[model samples]
Target: MAQLLACFRRRGGATASAPDEAAEDQQQAAPGPVLVELFSSQGCATSPEADAVAARLAQDSTGEGAVVVLGFHVDYWDYRGWKDPFASSAWTVRQKAYVEALRLDTLFTPQVVVQGRAHCVGTEQDALAQAVRDAPRYPAPAMKVTFQRPNPTTLQASFTGSLRSRVEGPGGASVLVALYENGLVTDCGRGENKGKSLLNDHVVRRLEKVAAVREGASARKTVSGTVQFPLWDGFRATRCGLALFVQNAALQVLGVQHFDLPDNV
Candidate 1:
């Protein structure tokens, strides 16, 4: 994991020659959505506020770039008193990856990672807004995704797209697809948030790496793959959505697109 985090540094350097104006213009014209990941927990007393903040950000679409918000419930605080039903150890590992990549001293709840480039206290709306505003934007991936319910317990997704970024370094780039649900209400019966009713939006239920963009990949690389997800008990296509993002070796997001699962599928 340390080795993986080592590859996650900011991507920048001087070019050998002048930049191409046309390419720059195209990039600006199709700036990608900003991914705002909130590492929170129902076991934490302060996380509810951050969760609310994330919900607000998810609804905001009037800006220059779209904001994609995801709520990751970490399980580290589950032992305090009441166990958070939404908490998962996998989510904790994800947050730790960011901690190592960002060189942070320790982990804490109500944390926000913006575009995998900036981190701030999740409760700090001003800081989160500033980070979003300051983060660099890339063009959205031109991908078409389709879904199918292979069985009552599974969902199959297939995607194809031309990735525009150059994938370099040992870690390469990954095509990650996240399955998320909205309009969740959890009643915390124990733990730090005991007796409080918690509302969560964009909660990531499952995250999978569908494919990898190899090192030194070309701009017109043709990539396609099918991934299967074991659906949760109360899964409803109408209440769920899929978010696909291409992340480079440095763990920086290059491009992202969201799809609303068809009700019939």
Candidate 2:
């Protein structure tokens, strides 16, 4: 069995380094799907135009290829007239790190990080389109995840996989398990979504760390947890994915996955 697993891993082109390095290299090697990270705030009045542009780009079609867009609600604008409910201090710090890494003095409301290397104003239509068109592709991770639901309201998922690493580094990597609930409606009386009943897909409500993958080694960790939703909303959990990426000392996402989550759960 072990021998078969090893063969399978090799056949699938598994890597030994952190997934981020592998992914970065893969993107450089081939034209893969572009992952667009939009940094915006609900409190910023200038963000809506950028948000609209992002939404449109997400819906565009480039053959069978598609662009992945992630909306990171920044909290820096909370001190204004409204406090964004989706804002997080971690996100604010993350943006600042990007600024420092890129050597910039100020951060804006609609900043977009493209492919971990390029940054552009989110509302710039020409720049956004060009970035998407010329975006480099990365290699997809060989991590296979299985989610087991013992009941209607609970799920148990176990992940076992290896990411291609660039070097033989020490310390196991960190497994970040993020759970996003789709079809969320918020009546925002204050923030950016204010006065608008926004229907958001892939809305991340819970982000949890299930385990710590050891360094210089591949991991096969299993985490069991339950998410109970009341019978009133009849809302079901739609998508769940595990992003196995390598982070620098600054905790920036060197590489990431916008993987598809199981819909039945």
> Which candidate should be chosen as best, given TM-score against the real structure?
1
Error of 2 at 53 (Å): 2.0
In the range 1-265, model 2's lDDT, one tens digit per residue, is 0111111121112222224444544433333345566788778776767777776776663432455566777888998767876677777776788888777889888898775557899889789878766665433334555556666655555555443332123544444545544444555577655686554443344455544544444322332232332222344633323333433343333334344444554
Task: Write down the lDDT of every candidate, Cα atoms only.
Answer: 0.77, 0.53
Task: Point out where model 1 deviates above 4 Å.
Answer: 1-29, 168-170
For candidate 1, the per-residue lDDT at 242 reads 74
Question: At residue 229, what lDDT does model 1 achieve?
Answer: 91
Tell me the tens digit of each residue's lDDT in model 1 across 1-265: 0111111111222101112445644553456678889999888999999998877766664345467778899999988987887788999999999998888999999999998888999999889888988987765565666667778899988887666555645677998989999889988898888888898888999999878888778655768778999898888877777777888777788766667676676
For model 1, where is the 10-residue window of minimal lDDT? 1-10
Error of 2 at 263 (Å): 3.9
lDDT, residue 66, model 1: 66
Candidate 2: where is the Cα deviation over 4 Å? 1-31, 61-65, 148-156, 164-177, 191-194, 207-235, 239-256
